[model samples]
Target: MARVAFILLCHKDPDAILNQVTRLTAAGDYVAIHFDASAAPADYRKITSALADNPNAIFVTRRVRCGWGEWSLVEATLRTLQAAFDAFAQATHFYMLSGDCMPIKSAHYAHRFLDAHDKDFIESFDFFDTDWIKTGLREERLIYRHYFNERSQKRRFYAAFALQKRLNITRAVPTGIQVMIGSQWWCLRRSSVAAVLAFTRQRPDVIRFFRTTWIPDETFFQTLVRHLVPGREIESRTLTFLMFSDYGMPVSFYNDHADLLLGQDALFARKISAEAHRLKQVLGALYASDRTDFTISNEGRTLFSFLTARGRSGRRFAPRFWEAEASIGAGRSLLIILCKKWHVAKRLTAAIRQSTDIPAFDYLFHEDDTPLPDMGGIERSLAKRGRHHRAFVRMLYDHAGTDRVVICLDTSSLDLLGDFHADRADVRILEIDCDLGDDYLIGHAIRVGLAGPQTSRDTFARLLPTIRRDMIHERDAIRDARFKNAARLRETATDAENAAALAVFLGVDDTTALALAQTPHLFVD
Candidate 1:
């Protein structure tokens, strides 16, 4: 097996840091530490003294006074990578991690997995295409310059932000480089690390451009890897599991996440706070055992159940589509009933099953008031506003790995047509009309149930045309909206304010404003 080098960055939780260092050292892996300069000298010394006897462990002498969303983080990581490469010349891979991160898989299993795969494990996504930060809008981070002091002074940061906005001194990325954003953590081959380091050394201009950019640490390496490396050799997935809150902050793992963490194939999990003493203990015990077969405890199962229920009720995104899909079966057709009326949904489900012999299929009713079974179904909490229908659509396509999905929604749920435009081939929508004299079904599957039971294969054949027409109309509407919004913004602003206002209107940064303004649909919809 190839030796793995771990580059850890830490500022707080000295004890947890030492434990991580000790664990990696015990696994016969090289460990490089980059303690924040603002951290206490006593804490640094404590970490250093604990690893004094381990020749494989080395703390970089050059430290950084790191601040959130600052270039200092990138500099510190580059320095640590260089130091690790210098110390362990034969190491095959470099894993960028944080002090709060701990390996979930055994060292042997991780090494074996890495040895078998030639590709680098780094999550990189086109910034314009995906919501990397889950901000609902994708381009805000790329457009604005976010400045924070070393101690995270909110007032100072906001004041600077407002000043920049007023003065109209917008920051721009380097020319000819497409912005790519992803999780900061990654596992890269040694050659890839070297390539990144060489690119930075050769392009000092790129470094300077990103220095003023917000959250450069997340974008810098990702942009380089996408620009420099072959796309085929990069697997766009991180090996670490980081649970994020609705506000985009990384949440600390607790005993409740034990089953979730244990079930994941990711090698590491991160952002473990010092307060989670019991979680740390459980993880430590699990990692210390040599046995590969482990079972979730009764308490873990109970906690998982509670968390699963809470996750569905919460307004945030919940990824239960896979469990729902699996409970039904693979290859089984899925009918997602998005109607608010329970009787309407029941009639639709019954009509579909009675009318068609579409092989094995299951029904998942999504309603606000009617509570469906936890398994093979989803029920929205009545107290909360439900705007996460798009998230549910995304989960079906992106997470659940379902190829064929039929959505049966009422006229009120027609707003969800926007989500099916991109994946119309894989998804079909049946717009059911509850009124007696109106067209009963008005989507891809058009059926006029006002006269008689219009349930047949020919009725289903008209679905694709209706769907195509709806998709085209929706797309055109979105295109027109973007154009009108951009035009309105351009007309209302003065010459000095046009660039900033245009960027805001287009939902992109000034660096991308010219290109984005020309193609407003790329960023807006």
Candidate 2:
């Protein structure tokens, strides 16, 4: 087996970090961990003590108080890489990972994959070609110097802005290097790692230049690798899978995402929290299983195809709908109410129209029969309730743009409008806040058949807490049935039974279903 070096940068969740270390050590790989200097000494001690018996595990002493978007992240990574290289001279590849990351494939498979490929596996793209440029990140992040301290951030930002406006300071690309940006996670050959370290050492000026630049972690390694190996073929795929929210924060995985994670080609998945104990255990067991073949099964592939088609359809329709809305000009503030109960929607719409002027608003009810704007073949693909809601919101944003305010009234609109929040600042989300007693609410739901006739008073009483909780938390029970079912299964079923049930439910093989079912229900409110 080819030796691989794992360089992990961890700050919080000592138990999860320890579990990762234990698993890596068992895989017969060298593991070097760099705990954030800001982390508690107890945490460091707990992790180190757990790994004391393992010869392959070593703690990187040269730690830094790593701050987000600061130079400290690069420094910690360099230190960890250097330590791994020093400790494991026979290692063929170096894998940079976070404490929250878990291997999606067996270690043997990862080693074989790396040994078969000569090119570095790092996601890189031209800096100017990225979406960040459209968001003015070029001016706010690259052109100006941002101070690390929170107290001085705003002051330095405005000062830099004023200076740029007054002096027209054109930020130049670093000497002898074209700018490249990518995900921070990467898998590189030992030779590539050595070359990167050497380049950083040889050019202190390059380090200094990126010191004040925002999120240098995303660019530093990418720029260096491209600069050092000018003509080398760089693979634009990172081994790690990270899903981001519309707000740009990584969406942490839960028990429900196990099937998706297992089907992915990525060797590793990140941002796993300790609270996801079931997920941690499932991934840990897979890592220890030593199964080399990580290919997606036929069922997984079919599901992937379906999801991909749905995504493509959504992308196609969203822009076209936006264009049509734009052509019509800003007509009126869109009032969208998504409710299955026609009576409830009618009552709410009437009350709002009576209290406020209806002439200024265009009322749209989101129901099964509601006709979506004709988008050629794309309109046929919006059969799924969730997808329809998401597409509708995307169209509304595209039509209204950022200038006009869109008022949304839906129990499930918050999640449907997730991707729109960052871009659609003009959207005003309003929920019907009711102060009616539980008896009234239960009676109403019963009348609407939302609650079954067989549901007894005692059962309703037990459900009151859930109702109150949902009210406060803004839960969409109908839309979140899968998650709710998973939570209920975790409480009621054995791990093996849960796995079997999930396999049948998700149409996945037993292994994939087991992986997901074994994960802890960390998403429970």
Candidate 3:
């Protein structure tokens, strides 16, 4: 039997299904683990203990924060591969998979299929404009890098000015930079593994450049393979669809997609439905020797659970709907201020640039304090100049057809949004506070790609306490005489009314608002 080493990078997923791991290990294969470094020591111990039971399994070095499009992940994967090669030199292939992934075919079938191909599968997609991925890659290299550099080096006045020219330079990255569409997960031969590391080591500068680039994972493998292996031997097709089920994000397979996953072509389905227990059961049976029970140590399943449950309690932007709405408004004139932290700001601005509507007002800087001096004088001279800065602000309001402003506040711009939102009730303010109860849910949902009824319940459990606590704080703040006077002036005639009004101000419901106004002393924890 030919041996394959499965290299899995996992984090915060003690509940990942180990049955699949068990099946692969039992199939005369080796398993090498690299759990996320941030995972608790206790959890790591549990993971090690569970894998230790399998003869082919052994825990390697600690993990790191493997951000998308970051160099850390490439470094981590390379280290893991070296360890795997050292631990099991005779293994025929080294397959890099995530905690959320699953093998679709039986172990025997998988081995046979690969043996026949004599090829390495990586999902490398072609870039034609208009496609989200293509546009995204372009912006990351050009526009985003400019704005990112500008914001970080605010003191370097000349550097900020230079960013404008750099942003428009088309085909900025090497034309030879061929992008392949494969699952970041790949099944590779020993030779390919050695080649990847050697190329990366040789081109340390390239690695350093990509370290700061966004979604480094997508490009890291593709760039290396394109540079190292001749394109002929490297199969661009990853043997999996790896599509997100709903909301246009990667997710677990639900009942509806089960047949699609089980169909003829693909060797593995990178994700499973977090909401669909049935899908899990089906996958469990495919890998299990007996019984229908599918619970195993796959972290993807657990992360899926955490996310879907969290998403239910929080706000979510359906990608398709977001795109459609933005599309309809695309041809229109609008003003969009990109006031997020450097990274988040770049993402939002890039999305805006991708939109169909060409914005009339595109402000990239974050702080209100640092208003462009050119704009500041115009604002002061607005009455005399008539069609100047005030006109610009008025034009923005007219374009939107509402007095309300939609501001996306990430980690950095929270304070500004908080103060601004409090003053402008007409503004439809959305605070994308990653710390909010529902925010946590959204994070989890995106990572694991699961959603449904049970997921909703989990969200409520996580969110309710947070809501209650926030309200409790609100109640106490309203008791001061000055607070009462201010409430009265704001048309909040009574304490209950004041609380209710405050709740509305805070974007909470009536019940939550009342709880905050009446029981400020109460702490949720």
Candidate 4:
């Protein structure tokens, strides 16, 4: 007879399971172990042979094949729980655990805690009413029939789901039960286990309903235990500490994570790395110690570290897919002049070139498909600006004698703007909120003879405000390299205003900026 009986479900790493069993039974707690049938037969033989003489350890008679996101895992758990429930008649509680789990507190403390509380420690909630399902299907998981394995046959699984959805086929929930969802770990009172087993015997239909349920192991015991135990007797929580990554995958604990695992508020920590031998040995020694369960503590330093780490991090600069010559971007600084009008960009390029020794290019990404500046000697097709956009741009830094180059861009190159302006380290954005109502485009088109001077300006000026607001929003919404680039942008309703803002952006004198702005016509062809 023991205070708590543990039902341990394990697939791989029989050595780890054996260690857990030996530790639990040594503290006078019963452990019923189940090895997944899909695993090597020799792993089962290994554990059974190791614990051949221990009376507190009993191997479950039934073995089942289990798969991820399938119903067989729940079957494995049910068999393991039944073996434990039948073996330890006088045990006060049954704790469900995985082989990856390690006790956070000494067995004596856990035993005493169960006796004091007398509550079932299980997480459960009404599935139809909660925001708990974060990544996958919530109602669709239950209502539809899944004939394909989601893990192994992703294409078939999706096809089946699509077919069911298209056909509008849905199954009803088993009668008289409110479906519940929770973490797949729990510790239940003896009476709770008895109630679950009784339900299994009386309601084979419900069991059948779950056999086709997706990830039933997460829902089965949680739903039943909620129905079986009274409200006051059920604690809506788990005794195990587990965490997931931002991508929803389980976060594995390593030897370096020993301190963090020890500091968790749970009585057990799970999904420990199988390769974490040092961590396992250190935690395994706790079974002999007299430590009780601890409160999460007032360690301001540790909490501070966690809060700081968990807080929103600075957004990363995504270099475009030109992977081969990415290193060239670091060779020199880049200033990209962005404007919605071709005339404005042309004017800015001419102004920057005349006022500063820095080389400037006129609309490098323009659709005209001209050769890149200083690359006129290369073959026309190879040197076309759009052929390898990012690579060709990055390579220009190597040819520039100075440390920086100014490249002007207009609406024709809007797609490149998204990728070009994103590099926070080496690239600075000079966005000209140039005059939207300027007739310079019409004037330039007439002078160039593209149209017969009868072409009217489109309604782009009416939409410029929203575009500007959206640009500011985009900058504010994304995290910077850590912060925004200094003095990188400006707005202007006239040439004088453009000069003032450009003076601040570039460290040029106000007089020089004014000259550059006023004398732009000197270089415009």
**Highest-lDDT candidate:** 4
The TM-score values for the models, in the order shown, are: 0.59, 0.57, 0.49, 0.59
Poorest lDDT segment (10 consecutive residues) of candidate 2: 481-490
Better of 2 and 3 by lDDT: 2
- Per-residue accuracy of model 4 over 70-177 as CA lDDT, tens digit each: 888888888888888888887888888888898777776677677778789998989999887898888988898876689899999999899989999889999998
- Candidate 3 overall lDDT versus native: 0.52
**Weakest 10 consecutive residues, lDDT, candidate 1?**
443-452
Q: Which stretches of candidate 1 lie over 4 Å from their true place?
A: 136-140, 143-151, 273-275, 285-525
Put down candidate 1 lDDT per residue, 180-277, tens digits, no spaces: 88888999999998899999889888888777677778888889998888999999888887766656667777665555566565778886766777
Report residue 92 deviation for candidate 1 (angstroms): 1.0
| Candidate 1 residue pairs in clash (backbone atoms < 3 Å) | 143-509, 444-463, 445-463
Error of 3 at 391 (Å): 41
Q: RMSDs, each prediction? A: 21.6, 17.3, 17.4, 19.2
lDDT of each: 0.61, 0.63, 0.52, 0.70
Number of the candidate with higher lDDT, 1 or 2: 2
Clashing pairs counted in every model:
3, 4, 33, 0
- In model 4, the runs with Cα more than 4 Å from the true position are 293-295, 298-525
Stretches of candidate 2 exceeding 4 Å from the true structure: 132-136, 149-152, 155-161, 230-232, 297-525
